[model samples]
Target: MALLARRVRPDDWKPIGVDALEANAMKVVVSTDNRSVIAGPGAGKTELLAQRAAYLLQTGMAPPPRRILAISFKRDAATNLAARVRQRCHRSHAGRLDSMTFDAFAKGLVDRFGQALPERWRPRPDYELMFPNDTAFRGFLFQDVGTPPKAIGSYADLQAISIKTFERSLLVGSPLPVMGWPDPTVGQWAADRFWQSSLHEGKKTFLSFSMIGRLAELLLRVNPIAREALRLTYSHLFMDEFQDTTQIQYDLVRTIFLGTDAVITAVGDNKQQIMRWAMAMDDPFSAFDADFSGKRTPLYNNYRSSPELVRIQHVLAQALDARAVEPVSKTAATIAGESCAIWDFSSPEIEAQRLARFVAAEMKAHALGPRDFVLLVRQKAVDYAAVLEPAFRAAGIPLRNEAGTVGAVMLQELLAEEASELLVKVLRLAMTKRAGRHWTECQEALGALRGISPEDEAAQAIFARELDAEATQLSADHPEPPASKADARTIVDDVLGFVGRERLIAVHPAYAQGGWFEKVVEAAAVHLHGSSAGAADWTEALDTYEGLYAIPLMTIHKSKGLEYHSVIFVGLDDGAWWSFAGDQVEATAGFFVAFTRAKQRVVFTYCAKRGARTKIATLYGLLSKAGVQTIQIA
Candidate 1:
């Protein structure tokens, strides 16, 4: 019964490369029992997780024919961790690990145990996998509903409602017993109906990402053979970003591993539980306490930020009623500069211009590159240009927006309000590092929007002319080309004005109404910010962009597990950054994550008035309450 009963010596068990606290964490990691580690930001949790997987195999804590299943919320993280295990551990031990995203793991289960699945949940052998784009998801939500409910304002609102409903019914296993026309019950019923339609009504069966857990849970709960297969296959289960694990995901994991000899380790900062709507429980480790007899392991050393920045975060965390883990950085003494500050502007436009000048000047003073700096916002608003473009143009800085930069949007989605997104697409194609055939690939993807054939010689000519391919070629040899940003902007405008206007309108009749062309210039700035790569390219692009000369503008969520030389938290006004939705636990946790992303310098910016409303910034008050003083710049 004792898995690690033939315990190795204390020195033999110590991890090869780790500090004191990390060594302590590594011991907890390899334990042949359940563990719940509340690893704060910069606690080296990622490394610890990889080491844990390695230790399980290397120490013989887990025997042969019993693999370790490591799950991450992001596919990239899963892949990265698996790579680390292979590099750090012996070849024989590393081969016993299977690392993948939760969705990927579930899909594998469904594929391997399809015959064991119940009739209601099983899919056809060749069933197609369809992930609905943003446009498609919105269309599905409003499809049969006669009148749009007042409660549902936009795609975002409807998405939140749908996720919460699914969590309550499917994940929590508690269907609200109500038959109201406009309630959580109605939303659940509609979502259930929509899912059923995909299973039975359509000739071609499509299983969405949302269906992965449902099908897996059903199979594990009903089929003994499937459960035994899982138990035999994996003796250890490790989940990263456990804070975001949903109810159905938890159930599936529990069904297969709990009460078995499998050792489970759930590692994440509960304060970073930003996905509360989709999660089954408010506390991330509730199931660990109730279902598994797990010991708590807390990793508190902060390695990413300076001492002053860590102190500031601690104060703010306490005020926000969060888990105030004391952050101590061993290397903090080497980092320099003011750790935090507040900058208040009269209006959003002025704020943008000032931020631009400040960034440009600071870069020169600090001898830092553009990538060392980042601007964090909640989401890309329709009016993102009004506040973002002024600073970019003034500083002559080219940028990349990583959030929601997914290509392959529906053709119908390119008209009227989102004409700017099409311009963004064009700018991305122009800025891409690809040349020749690779460059043609970018054009081919965009060609779908305007009905232009990718291989058409005429369209190619227009693209070459619009992008000023000749000038770019000439400037390529120059060490420092003059007016680089300006030239790029001109090229974007000239090409879009020449070809996009008529071609786009011809495809969508509604575009002929005008006013959309005015947004083309605004959309050009978007190209200055984000990448054209698919959404799955976040981790790789973010890593490359951080080291590149270009600046980054992204949402707080994307900034997780990432650090920068300088981080600017913008748009921190009341009802904006700290909206009612975030007033509680999850949002505060997100704020904590954002504040800790800087190692040397941290800047906080807010506008007094956004449009007509005078704003109240919640972060300022919370920090003030915590006795953290900040130098406010006018």
Candidate 2:
């Protein structure tokens, strides 16, 4: 059924939840020209995109059957942007916004139009997505003899055959010169070989996200019909976190929408380009301008951070780029005392213990919960977890290492995955005692899963009754919350049995591919086992599962686009941030990102015993210049 368009007057359309947009923001939002919005941290990038989407939809710029496509780097960011637009616009208008991550978008293209791909590049209908390690690549490159090919110089040369190498060579359909490779030809040959091996498994095909992207790009390029169809379907495009876009992704966007009438609005801060290691374009903003002839607009309002914190962030930002403009803070300090501080400790153990104690005391003093605080590291959050987790446990504070892996998946990624979300939602529904928004949402989801329409009140009523009976049975079977790993597994099984795994897979077809549903369930159970400890009861345990009552520990990369009342940066010495010396620009940008995540307080800890401070002396000096206090703990 085609959706009916709701036309709204341009004069009548207004920003939701705000009086009016900033002058520059308003121009960007209403402008029909392709635009590059370079915004610093806390500049309301996502909100601006959401508002712009609402503006376009409400004004009937993208009418019925013509949709707006919004692409974000992260799944959560995509979901948030879609949710905001849904809240601001009418149901029919909001339905036209297709918000998805770059990976998901590319995969969708491949999934729908894969048959258009040449046989050599085509994947099976049920291809398994694989994230191969360096070791696997090395084995594939130099099978068994432990001898390097003439093209491969040494072990160091093998490092050149990374995902970026594939993106540039195999994905782009030709070999491009790679920085560290001996020859582009050799790199292309290796990438092609890897792809062939990945896709040709007997009775089974394997594909990586990069492979899927390449296939998608190929499908669009080779099949003019598919390309034209996409161009005609979307009249407006939104690119969130544009600075992190990779070369292949940029090319994919150009392949589909470059010559079309679609207006592309890219929003990002170059200072937050932390994905360079993953082959993000070096000068994405300039490339976007050159390719799309985009009008550049810079936003200066800091809506997420306090004034003091914003000031501190500017100091670091200026250190990264001498000409950087300071963003004005729209928020005032709500918490009293120092907004930025540096803690110096003599040893790692002392640092961990003192930091734990400090967080515990601060939570009690400020009447804050575990969610109010977060710990950020430069990289390798698991290593930091090994040091900090015990101390936090000793302090009776639960610390969740979001960057750590559950099974083969990262904890944060697993929690955000569809299967995991489904399990959590079902568990929450089962434990519900009263009817409210949560219950209503859960019932709606269940009804949708069962193919029952909301318009059919009689069908909905019957399904709701059956759902209630199932929930009752689940509750009776497990009267108490999960107390152990076994209990968690049992609860998962019970929930799956109650809902019927087959029905869930039928509703969410993606779950049927690659055993993804089972894998997520396994990961969720493992995570529940570790996180449910010390939980008072079912509700408390569920709270922990839902990322409540626990401090979040993640890398600075993972901490992007998120905020907390207070942030603690651990292991600021050279050893933890070894890459800082080689790429100070990105490191400083990352530090700026971490600094801006705190609304009221930012704490930096340096342990003398962990590593020498010689490499990060400049960082320490920058903090000093920012007027941040240095507290030496005895």
Candidate 3:
């Protein structure tokens, strides 16, 4: 039935201010004065936000919203919210709430404000480079790092790295540029730096995202007409995932509503800021607690997940003592507790094989499709990071690696190598503002790699320095005749480099000389330049399997915004150092994040043996060995 047609209980105590609405939603909304919030896993925070938005508009509490800005963390989150708002608008006449990414906001600001710039001071085409597809990014990574990361997984890895570099290089300590209302001060800094750094020496060709954000901001500030237009539009700005909102993006939202009659109702789940790359800041308050100390209350309850899943998460929360978030209030009706499963293996090498068997069995018993579930992992570069990633890929199962979303599509080859994704992660973080170095290092490498496909030996030579060895090793192991793989790498490098060169034109300067994105891309590209022809086309030759194999292999960070029916953790074996597990608090928290993705079940798979010849040490076993035992299923 259509959601609109679904029975709307007037007294429905569903999650409102909090993920668990209960009857306290209206109370929290009233208490907070205007804005309300919801927090927690499976808390239905989005639903609550939607309900509150609908009601505020329906009751004439909010001024007519010409364009209600609904910002979200991920593309999925944005789309999800827009869908809900569209659905809810049927009952209310709240004009329209335009949904967009914070980056998009910054871009919009520049687009609106660019009128002030000299005719020549214009943005290049496709100012925004999409989040690379899992496969495409993987291909780029292989071409970059020469060897793949042991097992690091997730797009966040690259995003986090990129964000860190951006933040670190902000030596002036200026705020990032937002979209709608660009700050002139930030805009000037951006434009001046971009011309000096990126275009200087003609070293780097591609622009970093930080540069783009600042330029967009500059455009907004320079154009007086643009700022006035933004003021005229989007009177009331409601940003979702406000806690995760970056500084620049936040600035734009705040600027547009400055001194306006528009009421800004910032609603979001503060506890879910996992985007370290974007530098996700702590939320001011969860829906349960009032952000305003004077009038604070909480909506503490859950509307999703079974009691089993919720309770386990609760136990972890208590044990970990996570201070950033409030307690997860369980409201699911109790059912039989679903035990967390652990898989024992002799070695990390064997973990993949065993997990494959386990996953295959689950597929058979559950009649699951490739899209039905996923395999969660820690890092994308480390060995055994997501061991099951290759196992599933090699086995012909349609396994969704970390990078593919409807709005965000990656290349197909990225799914082949385990550490391939981290290449992108590392590069994103290390991106420099200077276009020349970034351009010279990255675009040149990508160009050479791209050449391999078109059989351009000269281009292949450029990136061969970096990837030649690894590519040759892979080719040698696989033993391909005449080095056909060499040509493939060139093609991939060319495509990515081509794209990077275009993107390079827009990044802010100052970051060009030294940043993760620049470093990783440069390092990988350089590596390829030195390698033999066989390795030049490594990106195209990476192995792949097709099927809905091990649910989906992803980083724990990626698991935060998703849910599954059952999740199994593998390679949690051996000592902390040897096993392919997240040993640090962040990694452990990532484990917890992965474990909590399930709505009904969770499975922890780790090897039992400590020092088997090939077994990797698992931090989980060591940590649990202190008092808690690693519960093995078989």
The number of the candidate with the highest TM-score is: 2
What are the models' TM-scores? 0.69, 0.88, 0.57
Q: Residues 62-175, candidate 3, lDDT per residue (tens digit)?
A: 445455566665555665665575456532342355665666566555544544554434544323232333353344333332321335334334333232232324421244
Question: All candidates' lDDT scores?
Answer: 0.62, 0.80, 0.46
Q: In candidate 2, where is summed lDDT lowest over 10 consecutive residues?
A: 173-182
Model 1 agreement with the true structure over 464-528: per-residue lDDT tens digits? 57455633543353212113445535554554563466776544332332233344444433333
| lDDT at 494, model 1 | 55
**Candidate 1 vs 2: which has more TM-score:** 2
Worst 10 residues of 1 by lDDT: 408-417
lDDT of 3 at 487: 43
Q: What is the lDDT of residue 592 in candidate 2?
A: 81
List ranges where model 1 is wrong by over 4 Å.
1-13, 90-92, 128-167, 170-192, 320-323, 333-337, 364-367, 381-390, 393-396, 404-406, 409-547, 581-583, 611-617, 627-634
TM-score of 3: 0.57
Q: What is the overall TM-score of model 2 with all chains considered together?
A: 0.88
